[model samples]
Target: MISSDFDSDGFVDIAGLDSTGRYLLVYFGKGANQFHGLTRYWLITKSDKIYSADLFKKFIPNLISLNKLSGKIEIYSFVNRKLNRNLDISVGYYPENLMFDDFTNSRTKEIICYGKNFGGISLITFQNEDYKIQKIDSENTYANVTPIFLNSDEYLDLAGISLKDQELHIFTNRNLRFSKSTIKKFTDRIAHLASSDFNDDNFKDICLISNSTNELIILYGNGLGGFPTAASFDLQYNADEIIIQDFTKDNLTDILFLDNASKNIFIKILKENHEWNSSIPLTKFNNLISFCLYRTRSQIGILCSEAFERNIFSIVNSSLALEKNIFTLSSNPTSIEVLKNTDEVINEICWIDKLDNNFCILKRNEFNTPERIYRFKLLRQFDSYVINKTLENQLDIVFFSLGKNYFDFVNFNLSDQSISRKTLTIYGAIDKILFFPTDHDTPNVAALNQRGNSNYITVTNPFKINPIIIDEPLVSSSVSNYFFDSVERILFYMQPHQVDTIIEFKSKKFNPTYSQGETKNHFRAEIKKGSQVITHAMDLGDTKKFDILNFFSSKGDGYLLTSFYQTDGYLPDSKEDEIILHDKSKIKAVKNDFSKTNEFYIYNENSQSVESLLSLKKGKRILTKKIKEDKEIREFTINLLPRERRELIYLRNNSPFIYLENF
Candidate 1:
């Protein structure tokens, strides 16, 4: 990945990787000087199982060959691992914009380079093996953004919106043939064209937004023949750029747009019938430049910012109504992603905050509420960034460029909440970072950098250590159990043997709190049985993010059997190891199967534990065994618990067990 540190205090601009798994950092010169090319190309390598960094004092001589050119120069390079060589190429005069498209086949490796200068798009292809350079096409009036490759073919496609004419051009193949008939003239500059299945026809359509128009346009047909018929709708707010995503889990395309002048956010929900149902203002701030969206199981997360501060929010009920503000902090957020299936919570959001010069995490619940979790500050600001969640929930590896001399490889554990950092030096200013996982089980991280003199490439093995596993579990206990008079409900907490315990309750009150309690309910003894492994906790309150009763019962045995529930009073914190039961007749016993093949359960009179129990894989039948005169029910439940501290078990036979306790 290539990133630019526009806010960096020093002259460092870009960072990337070299051929030998090393990092290359590049710094821009302060003044217009011929000698003001790449100041340094540092090399980072691994030896004796440790990454070492050093300046590449020898690579500086490569500048001697890139002496003089007629126009201001812009350089971009990529490493062809198959050919074992780096190709350095440049565009002159108008070099502010650049795009790269990689076309790799069995016999040939090619990269199509396009950029805008005083002229239009300058197109060139670099052949990897032979190091051959060929100029295919150039237009004097068209400026181009990064070219996106649509498929795997010898031909590559790129789109450029003409700065002078306000026309969209589609360049086909490396031959650079412009589809003139397909070019559409727009009233404003086309900021971006995103691909999505807007009609659910299994064909990806293009959603285009313009910098000067508040209307978002959708082209319905697949890209195989360009956009078919286009439709435009006036947005509630002006949109500088728009993004299409399935934010509401409705399987229909939704829209997120950013206002260039006001720094406000707007979301448009697409209904199941492919119509824009609602357009609502999400958030507003000053100097907002960009925004990105990430989807979890139950909610949509928005990562956005003003000029200097970044904020995140989620939509509740898929309603487009702004319900809760998740995270608001002082930093510029560059990127965000949701880590999947790593915890009991729906997902974890990770972002790079520039103001704090650190990375941060926002814990998201199934109901869309978010909590500030963890933050880690780095020694130097990042230039560009990319992150990956590895297999088996192993670790979240973040590859970011630092300063003009190195790339930082950092690893974060989602389960245990730990972080490790390493730095690599390269031969140029790192511009982009990409990860290529090989079939042989090893993966290499590729970094692209621009040295003032010539372009350089770097590659590094990011795997430094074996995956760490946590064997401990998080366990907690609660005592006070009471029901509120207004809601006519009861509340309790369950302490599972070795699993993370839960606080649960059922109430008619849509929103419940301690103030609503009519009387104090108490339990004599509640013992916390396992480890305290969770570093952070999020109390989602009565908001939709948390299903209090359901969340508690989904883990193991139903709350009534394993937890202390009281409808009339509160338990003192002093009691331990004993159960004080009142109104036992109010608790009903219902037979239900706990088998995976026939998992079903029934709720008792006025008790919501059935909802929680049903959420678990197995039903509540295991807790319904007949009580014998000699054998106590409590002893049998305790005996059924797993012997290992963090053992996985299934309620039914033959089914694999998942991690029951948090670690």
Candidate 2:
């Protein structure tokens, strides 16, 4: 069965290939549980199985039909309320399953088939305005085939269970020619196959369910990318199909299986000690297929359904000790209204730069010179030299080390606002120190050794608190911005561009939480180069300032529509808080304190949304006050600062506030 807005009415309709009756069935959905039988068209006289897939990835539904008698396969597109014939090819064997994918990076998707008498596998591709059927050099029958990128190559490869040989084969696709297939005799008589990063080692592993033997086989992968052998576990005695999921919420993949003999569901959990334990037992009144990776909003879990059972089970696990039955779907729950995701409001876009070069500070006049504009200055100084601060006197023991020929400690009593300095011997000049959590210490301690012009340094017991020597770099090499995608393990670095080693480093961890009060803040900017996705990245800025208005000037000549964020903290979602620009195609970033005196447009005075340079020069009356002298009150009026605030009292406060007259 497949679904789409067939008439383009913005209403989804359902279509299915009635294999038993050999009819193309269409059901028009008026939404809200209302569906009417639209029409039916005769498909084929002798039908084995009718398959529907997005063969061309048009997002429009397409159908593939195979004849049981002649083993003839036909491809059709839905048009004019009938199957429009596109391509037809005959396979010598009756194919049971089919997949539409591009294995050779040829951009054109090929129809891959696995079935009886098909001799391993068959690939049907369209070329020269004609369809052609080709066979990979192999002689066997595969139960199921899954395409995976098991290597660093751009093309996709295949993995399947060769039924005749009773072995698992990983086919590395080599261009449009023949593939290099490595057949591993792991388990016997494999029935079902699935490929995922089961162990979460950043590499995909192959899982197989054996027919003759009731065993679940896991082709555990190495981080370097190869599943050399199989790790077998005893499943239910009659388990037929399986899937790998984190059913236990351990971040480690667990196994779920369906029993062929009875309508029973079993889960084999991978334990921390490299063993499998059978999870809570569940029995259904009908048959089930192990599939459906479900997501309810941001929360993700498993969804499973049985044949005769009129309900779909939604299982959510917080940990191994507890589980929640989150939702129960109706007899045949197809789709739900999902909240379309907009770009998430920008969070803390901090400049975590070690260099204190660009810091803007605003110093406005406190007097009632409402006509005068605010002035800002840039001072070069290292910000956030203090790691942690506390009001309690007992928290005074935390010290920062300035390693000279001897170790100098600057201890502070934050409540008393006093500091005491002491000197003891260590190494050279200390660069960066971090206070990370440790089980050995009551409170975390500063961990670092002297790092001056050295690429790496080993920091042993700093004041003997959390004692360990870690030889890590003080920072990524002169890194201005480094964006790491935890999902893809791709590290993109923006340096001097002279470095020329952008994609060399492998990111160890992502956004690791720093100690309390410490920030591992990152900025984001799009950096796209061809097909490579380096869009989400932000380098640290000078830590001396808490606020920064960051922007990436487009190297291209065009005005950009972007999002604006204030780095002070969390901000509200407003349409007005967007990137505003004039007709200029280029962004001029002057290293001046212009943003320090950034002004907001006076909203109610006029409906205009911004105070551009033109509006600021007009000098409108912003503040009004009446002074009483000799029993005669006189009204005094003054202009806004660069067209900023209207009230004199609020302008004197330096922060933003509203004037409510006499109230």
lDDT of 2 by residue, 530-648 (tens): 21211122222343222122222343322223222324332222222233333221121112132343232111112112222212111222221221111110111122322233221
As for candidate 2, its clashing pairs are: 120-140, 351-541, 352-540, 352-541, 353-541, 383-544, 407-424, 523-538
The runs of at least 3 residues in candidate 1 whose Cα sits more than 4 Å from the true structure, single-residue gaps closed, are: 1-88, 103-118, 129-137, 144-154, 174-182, 222-226, 241-255, 277-285, 288-663
| Model 2 TM | 0.42
Evaluated at residue 577, the lDDT of candidate 1 is 20
Per-residue alpha-carbon lDDT of model 1 for 1-663, expressed as tens digits?
122322222221222233232334343323111112333343322111111111122111111011113332222232221111133344454344333334332233233333344455554443333344444445445544434343344555565566767676665554444443335878777666666677887655666676566567777755464666778876656666666666544467777777656566666776556777546555456765434443333334554433454222233222111233423321244444434343353455555665467776655444434433567787677635666666544454545663365666777665676777777666656555655454534345655455553333345665545221111111112222222221222222222333244222322232222223332223233334331211111122333221122111222232222322233223222111211122222132121112211122222322222211222112222232211121111110101111221111101111111101111
How high is each candidate's TM-score? 0.36, 0.42
> Best candidate per TM-score, number?
2
**Local distance difference test, each candidate:** 0.40, 0.44
| Candidate 2 deviation (Cα RMSD) | 26.6
Pick the lDDT winner.
2
